[model samples]
Each structure stands twice: as structure tokens, then as C-alpha cells.
Target: MEERYALLLERLTKTEPEFQKAYRDSLDMSWIYHDSALEGSVYTAQELKAAMDPTAPIVTDSSIQPICEEIRRHREALEYIRDFADKKRQPLNIDVVKKIYLILHPEEGDIKTVKYRKDIPQHRLYFHEYAPPDKITYKVRQVLDWVNDPETRRTRSTIRIAARAHYDLLRVFPFASDSGKVARLFMNLLLLRGGYPPAIVHSTERQRYYEALKGSSATMTQIVHESIENNLGSVEKLLEGHESKGYAVKV
Candidate 1:
């Protein structure tokens, strides 16, 4: 899987800058849509467009305001992680995780004041068992430390590290709400930091995702691998289309 991904990345790097940017623009919407859907929030096509495109006219309907706001906040969170990945200097830390949650839920206020759940709700639906309230902070810190360990980073495939990180963090279920979303974002943040594309766990695969969480990180690893391969295939097809149209394409 790593070998195939390396080759794909090499090929993708040769594409025109404009083409790459356009592809990323399309990806941003899909990423937002699927991530939101995983949290049981679905956005209409028009709503997604309005939320993502800065040039789109302002939305005026009162009823749709909250949906649009949530979508926009999700987009902002995505951008934040992407930018952090590009910089490649900031180590994955607890503060960074808190900041991401804050970005997704700005109404919650300052990062320093962010708190983990003190009690698990019996009524809420959860895919997997969570760490006890007392263990949340310890488990979260451990996961981050493991992810940032130099030996782990040097020896493990990025996909494995990312998958395990996502799995382990979600197992802890650190936050009261949006823990799943934050875990997904942190997974992509690690992927981007490692020079890989973000893995979109599509809404269609929601059942599989939950099931995988119940088992091992290997299943999640395969899901991420396939998602990236699918993305590479899309880029390959686009470049092939350009070539067929008599436009120059790098080999």
C-alpha cells in the first residue's frame, strides 16, 4: 500500500498547479459533506456550495442559518488543520486538539477553558465503549504522545499511525460532543503532515466505520488506504483527460 501510494504521489506532484488547486477545491466540499454526514448532519448540495464558496451570495433564509453556520465552521476547521500540516513544524499536542474542537465549536469559548466530559450520558448513542471520565485526559495525552514519538513516526506507515491514532482517541471519547468529528480531523491532520491526502470516511461507509472501530485499527487503515487510492485514481483520470485533449501532461 505504501509503495502504491508513493508512486501515485509522484505522479500527482507533476500535475499543473491550477489543476491541483481545482481538485483540492472539489475535495474540500466532499470532505466537509462526508465529515458532517458522519455526525448525522447532512447538508444539501446548495447549502454546501453556499457554505464553501466565498463568492456565493449571502444566505438569507432564517431556518437554514444554523446549518450553513455549522458547515462553514467545519470548513474552517479543515482549513486550519491543512495550514498546520503545510507548516509541518507544530507537533501534535493537546492544545492543538483543543483548538480544533474550539474551531468546530467556537461558541464554547477559549481553549484554556475547554473541558472533557465529566460523565458519559446513558441515553446518547455511542459506537464503542469510552474511557472513564477520569481516564479521558490521561488517555488523550498518551495517544498524542504515541503519535508524536520519533520512533513511531520513523517506523510506522503514516496510514497505520493515523488509523491507530483515530481509533485510540475515539476509544477514549474525550469530549462530551463532537469527539468523533475531532478524531477524524486529527487523523487527517496527521495524514497531511506526513504528505498524504486526507482520508474521507464517507457517510456511505458509516456502518463499516463504526464496526471497524469496534475491532482493530487495521480495518480503519484499509479504509484510509482505499480512500487515498480512490483519490489518486481520480487525479490520474483527470490528467489522462487533459492528455487526450492534446494538453501537455507531465509523465
Candidate 2:
């Protein structure tokens, strides 16, 4: 897995400007599609790409408009998160995460997200429960602090750190909605800052994904680490094919 990460970094260095942009687009759209899936979005990659376009004809079916708007907001949120890739930016801070929460939900009328919710919404995953609303702020801050802890940084692999942060945030359940989305983005922010490609948890793995969360943090971390490693392996093969100028993934 580390080898693949190194190869990916190397391949990135060798890419032409065109390949770089295409690769970034591939990563961004993939993240958006799968993260949206985790949050009950039904849009496919093609539908998401179309909806993200400014010039694409708007769909008039009001029934689907909600989904379309959801995709639109997600794309905006993802873009906002991506900007944190800058080395000068702090990616995992409370302010940054709150900004992400705001971006994911833009229809709050005049309500800015100032504090954690007092509502204890039930999870679709059986046996899943969130932190108490009163303790939400403290729990979230603990996770954020852990992400920045020097000892934690010195000991854990980037994958483990990301997985831990993701799992811990879910345990905290910071926002009223889109908590999973925020958690995944938070994990990827760590990965990207550490020079790793973002991880993808497919909708098809919904059961396993949730099950991991339900089990233990170690199990969940392994699941996330393996998912990221596998995705990087796929990227490596794709890059090799691109280097050979033969068609790789049609995606």
C-alpha cells in the first residue's frame, strides 16, 4: 500500500498538465459520487457531472429537483473542502469543519451552524446512536484535537489517522444531518494533506461499511485503510496504462 502511494506520487510528478487535471477531476467526482451515496443520494456519476455543470439544461421535474440540488450543494461543498489542500491551510480545525457543515447545507434560511444539534435523530443503521446533543461540542473538539496531536501523528499511519478521525466524528455526530458526509470529507482532508489520494467507500459496501462502524474502531480503521489501499492500487494500474498510451479505465 505504501509502495502504491509512492508510485502515485511519482506518477503525479510525471503527468502532463492535461493528465493532471483529468486525474484531479477523476478523484473529485469519485469522492462526490460515493460520499453522496453514503448520504442517501441516488445520483450516478454521469448525473452528478451533468448537474455540476453551469450550462447543463435544468431538469424541471420537481420530484428530482431535491436530489439535483443535493448534488449541487455537495459539489460545492467538495470544492470548498478541496481548497484546504493548500499547505498553508489548516484542514482539520473546528472552524474548517464548521465551514464544511455550512457548505453541505445551504438552505438553512438565516440559520448559521453555530452549535451542535439538540435533536437525537435515529440512524438507519441498526444499533447506531449519536453523542448526546449537549456533549456534541466537546466530543467533536476531542476528535479534532486528536487529529492534531503530535503523539497521535507520530505513531499512527496516515490511513489509521484518517480512519480514527472518521470513526470518532461519527461517534460524536456533529451536525443534525450530513454527519457522515462531513466525516468522510474530514478523513480525506487528512489524506490529501498527507499526500495520499482520497478514499472511496462505494454504496454497494453500505452494509459492510456500517457494520464496521458498529463493531470496533480498529476494525473500522482497517476497513478504511484497505479501502484506500485498494483504490490506490487501482489508480496505479490506471496510471501505468496511461503511461503506455493504451486505454485504461474508460472512466
Candidate 3:
């Protein structure tokens, strides 16, 4: 699994620089959301893929700066976290998220939200409908501890580790509005750096996706394993008929 992931990363890195730039730009644009401006509007996976076309219409340089900065910070933090994991020989760290939050929202203080209830256990199950009474800042330290814990550092397989890291963090719900966005970015960063192809669970998949995560406390291991297996299978299929031609960029 590790070998395959490494090979894919090498291939991705070696892709034409112009294509890489375009692909990265596409990723950045797809993540931005706005209710008013075209540049700010929410993008579905299909729209995002269509927008990736080098020939497709797009907002100009002036419109893309803010979103680009956020993407840059995300990728930069991802690189840092990947390096830290390799050097420290540990599971993903929560400090990485803190660093990312600061980079993405430097002026912002704690993310405001309702507080968690006293009746709920700190490590207990997630309540989707009930909003926690506290803001995101309150959970930062706890998130850090959860990731850096020695018991969570197991590495029998890269896929398993990466997938579980993603699922567990999603369940943890460390951020207010950005949990899904952060998880997707963080997971792809790990996959790309740790030698796997980037995977995005589209909004279209939200229902099954949440269902898959619903029993997370008891089903995390199984869910992670299944997700990894499925992702790896897709990679294998992509390799079977892969061509550099399809991904070429005009810019």
C-alpha cells in the first residue's frame, strides 16, 4: 500500500508543472463558498470538475486571491504536518490543526458556537442535531491530545492510518463551520504526502457518508478499513488505463 502511494505521489509530482498549477488552482477554487459572487458561490463536485477545464470560463486573478491564500495555507500546513509525522514517528498531531486555523483565520479568536452539555462525556458520541454551547477554541487542546496520543499511533498500514486519522478527526468535530472542509483538505494532504492519491468525498455522497460515520465510536476501525480499501481500489483502476494526456493544462 505504501509503495503504491509513493509511486502515485512521484507520478503526480512529475506531472507537467503547468498541469500541477492548474490542478492546484482548481482545488482552491472548488473549496471557496459564497452566497453572492460567482467566485464565492458553493461548488458541487461536478461543477468543480467542469471548472477544472483549462478552457472553461473562470473568474480572473483579482477574484481568486482570497481563496488562493486559504488553499496555500492549507497545503503549507499539510506539508508541515506530514514532515512532522515522518520525523516524530507518531500519528497525526492536533497542533497541526491549530497551526492551520491560525494561518487560515489569523485575526479570528475562538470560533463561537454553543457549548457541549455537562451530561455528555468529553469522549462520548457526537450529537448532530444538538449544537455544542462552546466555541471551537475550547476544543483545540482536546483535539491536539487525541491525535498525539500514543495508542492512536499504530501504523500497520498507511491506508488504515490515513483513513482512521480522517474519520476520527471528523468525529471529533473540532471546528464550527469548517470541520468538513478541514477534514477533506487534511485527509487529502495526508494521502498526497504519505503516498496516496487525493480523495474527496463529494457532497453528493453526504448521506451515505454520514451514515458510514454514524456509529463511529464502535465502527471507526471497520469504517476506516473499508474506506482505505475502496480508495486503494480506485487508485488501482486509475493506474490500469492512466494517461498523461487527459490531465494536460493550457496554463
Candidate 4:
């Protein structure tokens, strides 16, 4: 599996600039849609295109305005993480995680004042267990420490580390809302830093995802591995199509 992933990355480097942009654009839309869907927020295909595509016609429906804004914020948060992954040399920290949360909810206030859920309401339903309010801070710090530890990075596979980080954060459920999404974003950030593509755990796998969370990070790691493999296959097909069109293959 690792060999296949490495070969796929090598092939991807030979893709044309236009194809690369189109592929990334498509992946970004799918990434946003599936991630939101996993949390039970469904956006229609038309709505997603309208929000994500600058060339698409402007949306004027009053009812859809909030949806569009939410999509925009999520995209901004995605872009922020991508940039951070590319340029930032420092290890992942609490502040960076808080910044991601703040980007997703600017209305919530500044990063300095970012706060976790004081208490989860008993009336509310959640798909997985979360740390109690009193344990949120300590659990979050532990996750950061584990991910940032030099020995952890040196010994563990990137996928395993990323999956464990995601599971740990979701278990902590630091924020009252969007904690799942933030956990995913952080996971992808780690993957990108390790030269792997983002693992877009599709909404189709929602039940499997929840169940994995209920168990251990090992299950989550397998899900991530499969997600990466799926993405690599998708890109491989795209490259094949490009080659069939009489483009000179570099690889």
C-alpha cells in the first residue's frame, strides 16, 4: 500500500497544470460537502457549486444566504490549514487549533478568548462520547503533546499519528459545535505535513466512522488508509485519461 501511494505521488507530479487545478477544485468541493454531510449538514450539489465556484452564477435566495456563508467559512478554514501546513515549520499547538476554530466561527470572537464547551447539555444528542467539561482542557493538551512529541513522529506512521490525533480530539470534543470538523481539519493538516493527501472520509462511511470513533484509533487509521488509497486511485484514473488524450506522459 505504501509503495502504491508513493508511485501515485510520483505520477501526480507529471500532471499538467490545468489538470492539477481542476482536480484540486473538484476535490475541495467534495471535501467540503462530505465533511459537512458526516456531521448531518447536507448541502445540495447545486448549492455547493454556487458557494464554491467563483464562475458560477451568484446566489440571491434569502434562505440560502446563510448556507452560502457557512460554506464560505469552511472553505476559508480549509485554505488556512493548507497554507499553514505548507509554510509553518513549528509543531502543531493549541493556538493553531484555536485559530482553526476561530476561522470557522469568527462570530465566536478572537483566538485569545477561544473557549471550549462549559457543559454538554443532557438534552442534546451526540454520535460519540466526549470528555466531560472538566477534562476538556487536560485531554486536549495530551493530544497536542502526543502529536508533537519527537519520539512519536520518529516512530509512528503518519497515518497512525493523524488518525490518533483526530480520535483524541473528537473524544475531547472541545468546542460546543464543529468539534468533529475541527478534528478532521487537524488530521488533514498532519497528513499534508507528512506529504500525504487529505483523507476525505466520505459521508457514505458515516456509520463506520462513528463506530471507529467508539472503538480505537486503529480502526480510524484503517479508514484513513483506505481514504488515501481511494484518492490515489481517483488521481491515477485522471492521469490515465489525460494520457489517452495524446498528452506526452512524463512518467
Candidate 5:
């Protein structure tokens, strides 16, 4: 995994110019997508045009602050993830995963809704609806047990657990807001703390994003591969032509 990260970083740095250019362009596109996602709808062509207006900043201070704050909280969350990853004797059970998500989105501590889904056999599915606190706690626990079980100890199995941590939690809308981002980070963190460099889903690719997540029964390979490809592509582009100006990824 460390080697994988190194290889990815090298590829990205080599393509700095093209990578950075694509990154900038994609960020512009992501702003539009973010705005629409925030509004809970895909953008109309006009709305996308409006989003790209020169005078209109793509991200507002309100949204920006939360992102930065999340990053800060992320630093703290990583500590717990490190501890959990090292505890190989115990598979991460539900209580533990929820605790991580709570650390990431503390504000979601109080949201409640009465809805549920049992589609995923091993998971306490909430089926595209807000889950009540009690129900969420129950399902998360079930997920943890499945992950920790010795039978599911393979890399692919762990990856499947990580993917469920996203699909189930996000689809359930466990948090009042930022559930998607938080969930994405949570699953990736599980991978990262376990030695993976972390898979990143760039906000720019909507078709790929939804399609990657659209199946009635989504799998970890689908989402993980999407993220890996996106991350590799981004890093490769960044390294090709962009001037680092002394900025480098922290070791």
C-alpha cells in the first residue's frame, strides 16, 4: 500500500502541468455540481452557466468554512482510526464506526427520522431515508460485526465492509448534512489507516460518480475503483506540468 501511494504520487508529479490544468478545470466544474447537489437537484444548463459566471465565486464562505473545519476535525479523527487499525484482534464493530462518523460530523448527533430498509442482508438498511438514532446505532453495530468476523478478513472483504460503511450510512442519510462527504471520508479512512493511501472521489465527475454508486446493490470494488482511478488520474496530471512552488504532499 505504501508503494502504491508512492507510485501514484510519482505518476502525478510527473504529469504536473496537465494534472494541475485538469484539476483547475475540474474544480470549476465541481463548483457547479456542488451547488446543484446542495440544492438536491442536478443543475439546469442555465444554472451551470450561472455557477460559472466570472463574478460569482464557486464556493461561498459558508460552505468553505465547513470544509476547512472538517479537515481540522479530520486530523483528530485520524488518531482514532490509527488506533483502530492497529487493533487487528478486534474487527471494527458498529459502535466504533459511528463514533468515527460522529467525530467527523458532530452536528449530526441530534437528527432523527423514522424510516428504514433491510435490503442489504447483513446491514440494517435505511433505504434512502433518514434513520432514527436507535435504528442507526443498531445497523452500525451489525456492520461492525460483519467486518470484524474472521470469515470476512480478506482484502476484498474489508473493502466490501468499507463500501457498506458508505452506501448504507449515506443512503440512510444518518446525518442531517454532509453525510455523503463524511461517509466517503469514513470508508476511505478505514482503508487508509489500514495502509492504503486513501481513495479520493473528485467532485467534478458526476456521471461517473452516480453511475459508480447507482446499482440497487453497490459494491466496494465499484466505488473504490472509481476513487482510485480518479485519484491516480488527478495526481498524474498534477505532477506533469504544475509548479509545486514548494508545496508537496505531507509524508
Candidate 6:
């Protein structure tokens, strides 16, 4: 899996830079749509897909406002996260995480005001209780420290970091709103910074996605790796067929 991943990354660099930019932009749509859907979006995948295309005709419907607004916010947040993730050379830290949380839900509050919750929160459906409010800040710092520690970097696999980090964020449940989106965004930031593709959790696989996060098992990591592989595979197939055409990859 690693070998194939490396090969695909090498191939990506060979594609036209303009095409690569467009391809990456398209991924923004996929990540936002699927992530929002997991949070109980009522919009169909096709509807969400069409919504992202500027050329698609806009029809007003107050009934679908919830899903549309969710998608709109998620798309903006993911774009900002990717831009920051691509340029930063420093280790991931609490500040970075908070910035992402703020981006994901700007309506909640500003940077300083929207720090970790000062009260406990619970995930009833999953029966997962977050760390107590008093402990949330410290535990979050520890996770960031692990990401930056040279020893952990040398010993831990990206799968472990990505999977465990996702698991930990869910357990921490740090933000007042959009904690789930922030968690997924932070996970993808790590992967992208490490020279890997985004580990998108498809909405169609929400059952498995939730169960994997709940179990915190190899299956979760496996699902992530598969998403990355699937992304690369699509690009590989695209280049094979349209190497000279400079194709735009659809999400």
C-alpha cells in the first residue's frame, strides 16, 4: 500500500500544475459533502454535487436550507484548512487546531473566545463521553505534543497518528460546534502535510465510518488508507486515459 501511494504521489507531480490545482479544488467538494452528510445532511449526494458547480442553475428552496448551509460552511472551512496545511512547516499544535475549529464554525465565536469547552459534552448515539471540561484542554495539548515529538514521529505510523488522532478528537469533543468536522479536518491536515492524500470518510459508508471511530480499531485506519488509495487510484486512472488532455478530476 505504501509503495503504491508513493508511486502515485510521484505521478501527481508530473501532471500539469494547472490540472493539479483544479483536481485538488475538486477534492474540497468531496470532503465537505461527505463530512456534512455524516452529520445527518438530508440532501442527496447528487444534489450536493450539483450545488458545488457554479455553472449549475441555482434554485431557491427554504426547505433544504439546513443541508445547503452546512455544505456552504464546510466547503469554506476545508478550503482554508488546506491552504494553511500546504504552506506550514511547523509541527501541528493547539493553536493550529483551534484555528481550524474556528474556521469550521466561525458563527460560534472568535479565536480566543472559542477555546475548548468549559463544560462536559456527550455523544449519546455513540455512547461516547468526552473528557471532562476540566481535563479537555490538557488532553488536547498532549495529543498535539505527541504529533510533534520526535520520538513519536520516528516510531509511529501515519495510520496510527491519523486514526488515533481522529479517535482522540472525538473523545475530547473540544469545540462547542463542528467538533466532528474539525476532527476530520485536522486528521486530513496531518495526512496532507505528511505528503499523503486526504482520508475522506464517504457518507455512503456512515455506518462503517461511525463504527470504526467507535471501535478505534485497525478497521478505522484501514478505512482511511483505503480512502487515500482510492483517491490516488482515481487520479492514476485519469492520467492513464488523459495524460495529454490535462483532465479535471471530479469528486
Top candidate by TM-score? 4
* TM-scores, each model vs. reference: 0.89, 0.85, 0.55, 0.92, 0.54, 0.81
Per-residue lDDT of model 2, residues 72-130, tens digit only? 77777777766786564554678877877777776543235366777787654424667
lDDT of 4 by residue, 1-251 (tens): 55666777677678777777887788888899999999899999888888888998889998888898889899998898889888757768998889899989998888778888998756533567879999998999999999989999899999999999999999888998899899999999998877788899989998999999889888999999999888878877877888789876565
**Model 1 CA deviation exceeding 4 Å by range:** 1-21, 247-251
Q: Candidate 1 residues 144-215, lDDT tens each?
A: 999989899899989899989989988999888899899999998988888787788888988888888888
Q: lDDT for each of the candidates?
A: 0.84, 0.76, 0.50, 0.87, 0.54, 0.74
Q: Which portions of model 4 show Cα errors greater than 4 Å?
A: 1-14, 123-125, 248-251
Q: Which lDDT tens digits does candidate 3 get at residues 40-85?
A: 2354444544434456556456655455445445445545545654
Per-residue CA lDDT of model 6 for 1-251, tens digit only, reads: 55666777677677778767777656766677677777775467656755666666674776666556667667777776678777867657787888887765676677677767776544443446678888888889888887788888799887668777877887788876667778888888888767677888888878887787667557778888878778777777866876657565442
Best by lDDT: 4
Candidate 4 weakest lDDT stretch, 10 residues: 121-130
Q: With candidate 4 superimposed using the best TM-score fit, by how many Å does residue 134's alpha carbon deviate from the native?
A: 1.8
By TM-score, highest first, what's the ranking? Answer: 4, 1, 2, 6, 3, 5
**Residue ranges of candidate 6 with Cα displaced over 4 Å:** 1-22, 45-51, 55-60, 64-66, 118-125, 244-251
Stretches off by above 4 angstroms in model 2 are 1-3, 9-19, 88-91, 109-113, 246-251
Clashing pairs in 3: 5-195, 34-40, 114-132, 114-133, 114-134, 115-132, 115-133, 115-134, 116-133
Q: Give the TM-score comparing model 3 with the true structure, all chains together.
A: 0.55
RMSD of each: 2.4, 3.7, 7.6, 2.0, 8.5, 4.0
- Least lDDT summed over 10 consecutive residues: which range in candidate 5? 118-127
Per residue, candidate 5 scores C-alpha lDDT tens digits across 1-251 of: 45666776555555436555565445435433453353244544434433444454454557454544444455456556656666766655555655666776666462332222323323322224455555765665555566566676664554566777666666555544445655665676577655565555544544555554555436545756666656556555555445445545434
